[model samples]
Target: MLETIGINPAELAASETLLKLLISTALLITVVVVVRALSARYIRRNVASMELRRRWLVHSRNGLLLFMLLGLIIIWGEELRTLALSVVAIAVAFVVATKELILCVTGSILKAGAGSFNIGDRIQVKDFRGDVIDQSLLATTILEVGPGKLTHQRTGRMIVIPNALFVAEPVINESYTHDYVLHVFTIPFKRTANWQAAQQALLASANEHCASYLAEAKRYLKRLNEYRGLDAPSVEPRITLQMPSAEEVHLVVRIPVLTDRRSSIEQSILSEVFSQQEFSGAKEKALEQEGSAPTG
Candidate 1:
């Protein structure tokens, strides 16, 4: 072919490698553009689940681009097989140097894919405990909250945990399977106040704020009862009054709400139950009488 084109065979061979490289480069560029365009269009039209769409793009791009690039290299030069072997060697060295980081990243992906934890779930893994804020390739982020309520104790701090810890430790998610979280608050009562009335008021407050979720919860309870041949208690909310301390009765108010809203629900239930005129009247009279007497 070179002789017919009035080109020397040596010159043709010299330029052949360069021509192949250029063609391969152009093909790579075309693949990138076309893939990106198609991805954008598909996303626009399908509007699929966010998590599913992201996985789709990542796996598709990695497989397609990697196949094309390797195919081009192999076609251009059989010597490229040696290059692939060298690249594998470098990858092994990297694995050794950043073993922990690599492991964490792998764990994060596996945990997320397995639906072990998700954003908004209250999770306690190893020593770190909080509601998940975000998840990334390398780390999982959380807004630190305590056990009592969904109070953001680490107000400004965002926890970044490497994914590998999931494999090393057990993950406890209080809100993973359950849609509603229960928060218990204790309010003190005077030895003289009507304890039963206080209990009733507290239970009423819990029901007022969280009655919506009770029906579904009761249905689940009903199903469990049928399976076990047991009688499940009524789904209506209840408050337990206990006297752990000598001077006061402990009104244990349990209210149900989403995990992140636990604190707010607690506060609302407390305020409403304690603020009623019927409940506060005697306490107010006692306080007024005490204040009127001078403590000299």
Candidate 2:
């Protein structure tokens, strides 16, 4: 029949093989599309966190890939096993020669498994600090902050660091245990100013901003002490007067607010302190007293 149609038998076999490959590719693509759509509709949307959604998507994708690999084995013939093993061996050798790359991949796996940090967690590794915007098999991306910008505010740059950094570098996950960070700042006033009044004003302002988180902060400290036997640090708004010199007195205020809003919250408290009528009124009264008193 092939001779009559002027088609060679070898050519016909090759064509058949190509057709099978194409069909298998198309089938795999279709399966992926359908699965992704279903997962996005029913699985991803209901997930509470971005990191959880990403995990679900990755699991679905890997499952689809495994299914496709099995399907390809049947489509490509049994003999492809030798070719697959050869390819795998070559890949292993290549990865072995590139030690750093393998370490990065291993780090990614370990970091994800350990759950030390996740996407959307603010972390500092070495000198780089940012929110983890992406974590992949080889790298983790950070939305850059600090070093010429506000410590907690985004600098509008992305820093992609090799995941291998996680293997060796100490990582500070600010939001790992809690969303609020202890924000501390100091304001100095002239010694003659009403430092007591200013300290009261600072406490009031900080408490107004941080009262909501006080309960949880206290509870966390309690549990922390129970678990680790570490002394529980004060988590409430507190003011300490620091006198570096007789001429200058500083009021140090420590308050807890959402980590991302540390700078803004600090600014708010300071603004409130300076704007406090009682604080300002005290200063005015002091000035009047000085003006009326006999000159030294």
Best by lDDT: 2
Poorly placed runs, candidate 2 (over 4 Å) = 1-30, 43-93, 147-150, 185-200, 216-233, 240-252, 275-296
Q: What would the per-residue lDDT of candidate 2 be over residues 1-296, giving only the tens digit for each residue?
A: 98898999999998887887888778877987797688777776698877677756665665676676777767776557757676997878887899898889788777878888866788888888888766667788888876643345778989999988888987888776456567667778787777787887778888898887789877876776677677777788999989899788888888877756887888777777676554534677878889999986
lDDT of each: 0.70, 0.77
TM-score of each: 0.56, 0.63
The candidate maximizing TM-score is 2
TM-score quality measure for candidate 2: 0.63
- Pairs clashing within candidate 2: none
Candidate 1: tens digits of C-alpha lDDT, residues 1-296? 76888989887786887787778778787877797779867865696676556555555655565667676766666656656676997888888999998898779667867788765677888778886766666678887766434343445557888888887788887774355555556777776666667787777778888777777766765776687688865656667778877877877766656655667777777678667735534665677789999887
* Candidate 1 lDDT trough over 10 residues, lowest sum: 147-156
